[model samples]
Target: MSPQHRLTDLPATARAVIEDRTGPLTSVDMLSAGLNSPIAARLLLDDGTSIFVKGMRTDHRWVWTQQREADINRHTQGLAPRVLWHLTGQGWDLLGFEHIDGVHANYTPGSPHLPLVLQTMSSLAATTAPSSIDLKTMPQRMSAYVDDPRALTAFDGSTLLHTDWKPDNVLITGNRARLVDWGWASRGAAWIDPALWVIWLIASGHTPHQAETQVRAHPAWNTALVPSIDAFTRAQARMWESIARTDTPGQWTHHMHQAALTWAKHRQ
Candidate 1:
């Protein structure tokens, strides 16, 4: 019921398209505090059905990113949001899907979510490129990650990476766990995603030491090099800072360019 529950930066065209699809929207609200794209105040349709919507830019990388995510979400069976639309006509670039009632995995995790969270990492990682020999989407690979600590180490690029795999990206409903927001995902080393999530947890409130323990305890990143994990966490902190200062989407370009150098170092 507060201002945080309403969408603010949406263009007029996006709002209209959403209205055209869902009928007259009511109780327009927004979810606040995230760094990437804005996702809030899900639209409710005529039958009392609701769908989450996120208005984004037309960056080809982002276009590729969201398209891949939509595929992965549906492919994961139930661990993600369904992609109902990506409105490009109205500067909306909307993504509509079923509304979820779970909260973000922001704090130290407990049972189901924790176990499944690790499992999801393993699952996504299982699909990474067979070899790190030639990595595509290099921009998302490591260029923007220059500020990340993991930039100092080599990323195998063989495992499927949920590049934005943080606690906030994981949603839990009852004992069930569903991974969401695969926008920055790719095929990379084992610890990349888990390491990213751990740093976010630590920087947000969780202690770095404890976060390292938690990440190491996970079967996915646990098998990875401890030093690489550390560097990854360091770089992730820097990336998060960049995200916080993201006044416009254009900065994402600089972020990737810087990260490329870091990721390239890991050619080994």
Candidate 2:
């Protein structure tokens, strides 16, 4: 990933484009950078409005993710912050979003945020993928990690999925939770989101059974067949194993790998 760039680091042309829409920028507070974007921040406009902005170089390999996020945001309002503007110029592709105030969700066992997260997931589960926009299917994305390619058939569906369930991607605001980072969104079976949550829940100190019990509240959980869930857990274990191997042996990835393996074992 490219090193994160501060708002002031943007080329004059790029900054001008943003200023054209948002008016003069008074200051910018850099936010956490994601794997796909080098620029993530809250830009304060001269008029006192704050908008979250994230961008990548125009020639970067993951530049497509910026476009995908802008397209997906239209379908994710209430569940995600709205996209306010998109601009590409002076070698940068930037997206400005309606600023949201919230903290990363606490996924620990019995955290009050759990219910809000579940509610957000349930709403996402009911959302239909936009047929008009091309989206990678779950089977297409996960096929390489599974032992039997045929096992991926169980992942087929029309529901839209956030896929990435890291605690940081879920923001708890007041009585509700909102998801961010739609760059990895995909089309998948409704149960897939709940299944994905089980691994994160385990990583956050919930036993496999405890995590399973929590996801059981979502109506889609019943639609998840034993064999399909088994296949998914196994596939995820392999995926995270690959990630941990290729990336630096960071504790977060290591813990996620272990959590995936634990879920796979429990399913077995």
TM-score against native, each model = 0.68, 0.94
Query: Candidate 1 on 87-202: residue-level lDDT in tens?
Result: 55554456777788887764553433556666666666666443422234433545665655345446655565666654567887766667776666566666676766654444
Superposition-based RMSD of candidate 2 using all C-alpha atoms, in angstroms: 2.0
Where does model 2 exceed 4 Å of error? 1-13
lDDT of 1 at 244: 47
lDDT of each candidate versus the true structure? 0.57, 0.87
lDDT of 1: 0.57
Question: Per-residue lDDT for 210-243 in model 2, tens only?
Answer: 9999999997999888889999999999988987
For residue 235, what is the lDDT in candidate 1?
A: 52
Query: On a 0 to 100 scale, what is the lDDT of residue 159 in model 1?
Result: 64
